[model samples]
Target: MRIFLFSILLLLAGCSQTLHINERYSASGQNSRVQYIVLHYTSADLNRSLQLLTETEVSSHYLIGDRTPTIYRLVDENRRAWHAGDSQWQGRTWLNGTTIGIELVNQGFYDTPTGRYWQPFAPAQIEALIGLLKDIMQRHQLPPGSILAHSDIAPQRKVDPGPLFPWKQLADAGLVPWPDADAVARQQALFSASLPTVQWFQAQLMRQGYAVPLHGELDQATRNVLAAFQMKYRPARYDGEPDAQTA
Candidate 1:
């Protein structure tokens, strides 16, 4: 009788432990409102990136390797990952709540003449990124312009997934808008003779979903927003100044 009681107690304890483990693994408490997919470059090699993302608290939903176009899923899509730190978009802060971060392996930026550094993104990696992005966008019902870079949300401090990223290629696939060349050309003509009012340009940028101050002054905040915009829409020249074409 004593042995039987002991065995029953052990069985109940084991069952309780199993139930707790199963509850922990279940998705009862996970976030479900994933809306945006943010892209980033690891600025490190594949192995290092994998190790850091897996071991460290910082993580992303997916990591795309440089050599091959394959994507490694690090975090589940339904759960929130620890990425997009100190970010803001369209007046919303802390983008991690609504975004899925995808980190690609790359060296990021390199110095060049004119004291400007350029970053190189591999063509194959970008191609792979497009497919992954398409699937995520479809799953989340993300809009055409919903796809964003790490730098786009954190322009004040971060610059990863830098200027070399192929926004045009993504736009070609109907992922984002390709600024109307004709509209830009017309704006360029108007801007050449005289710079448009700072307020006018700011309004256009705001209309395009950039967070610009409405003060009508081309200040640092405005410049940062313009630089981010130019990097995405007009990659050829991201001088940050409201030049003829940018204006």
Candidate 2:
């Protein structure tokens, strides 16, 4: 009886060890604590973009192709991808730690010799993005404003998902906060009046969750933040100057 009991104990211990090993492997291979969903443009074709994201050091959680409204999950939602680098938003830096990045295939911001520019994103691609974003937002309980662009967070160094991105369409779909046009028009009187000091503009940008130094000077960082805001809101001109309309 004693010999039989010893053998049974050894077998139970081995099973427990195996179970612990399996659990460890599973946890190490997957992602966790996914919070924000960030949008980006690959600036490359679909095949090349996928190859680069999967094989190269750069990767995203999801990739949307042109002409098709399907999303390719490159990295699992639980694992961290190396997409966002040197980013900041709402006074917080290093967005990769808290965001899931989505890369859309496109060649953004091509300039012509005649000073005209071209930026094209297919309708199917936008549709795919909407669906994917809806799923991610629901799963993670992310707020509508948390759905951000790479350029929105890192304006100085990145411009993916550029001005051509139809942010208004997303807003119309109840995916994000569209600035109240009436409020903007009413504020236009204040903006068009006396040229507000750089301090005032900096405060506004800070209140809007953009990273800017409160030095009261219109520095490059301030210009970048203003340009990002105008790209999303004004859209007509994003020259970074606090003109009568943007002041």
Candidate 3:
């Protein structure tokens, strides 16, 4: 009877998960919890950024200011930050769990009577960002080019970290990949003569880690995805249309 009662107590303790785990054994197949780092623009100044991120349900792991380029850690890295909303990448959805989000203080864009104007990231801010990214990537042991723009994860609904976000800077810093200019020029000449089909474009974007459709139609959704890609690669023009440059 005493043995059975003791067994019952042990079973209850196991069920409760109340015992301290042993640290002697380690698994070789486990990866870091952080697989990607997402960049975003707060679309507000420092004061408003704090208010918005703190007052609302929206939050990020880090927030960088523009003027002095101050770095703020609003959310701990061990915890999930509510930054990537309705986002997906590499077939993984709801990236708040496996990603770290960093928000930059910028107004994003403004639509005037002439056209839309995007805000450029400050130089000091970019420098600070590079340092911060290095620290995070070092700590997490993340691979190069694991950084993603918010639009890359959710092209349909979000466009922050827009055209002026300077992806090439990240690429130059060895944080992201940049296309070969010569290769792009040659491809441009060929595409300018004869643009590829919608199916081909869809396949290429999908190859570039975009969740574009393969239905062989130029739908609005597909255009949005293309626009997101263009915004990062070719910032001069991103009308979401399949043209020679886009091709």
- In model 1, the runs with Cα more than 4 Å from the true position are 1-32, 112-117
Candidate 3 lDDT over 53-159, as tens digits, reads: 98899999999999989999999999999999998888889999999999999999999999898888999999999999999999999988799999999999999
What C-alpha lDDT do the candidate models reach, one value each?
A: 0.84, 0.82, 0.93
**Runs in model 2 lying further than 4 Å from the true structure:** 1-16, 19-32
RMSD of 1: 5.2
Q: For residues 156-242, what per-residue lDDT tens digits would candidate 1 score against the true structure?
A: 677667778888999999897777899989978978988888888889887865667889998988888788878776778776888
Q: What is the lDDT of candidate 3?
A: 0.93
Candidate 2: residue 90 Cα off by (Å): 1.8
Poorest stretch of ten by lDDT in candidate 3: 238-247
TM-score of 1: 0.82
Candidate 3 TM-score over all chains jointly: 0.90
Among these predictions, the greatest TM-score belongs to 3
**Where in model 3 is the C-alpha error above 4 Å?**
1-19
Residue-wise C-alpha lDDT for candidate 2, range 83-181, written one tens digit per residue: 999988887788887889999888776768887564678998898788888888888877788888787888888766777889999999889988787
TM-scores of the candidates in the order shown = 0.82, 0.85, 0.90
What lDDT score is found at residue 93 in candidate 1? Answer: 85
Least well predicted 10-residue stretch by lDDT in candidate 1? 18-27
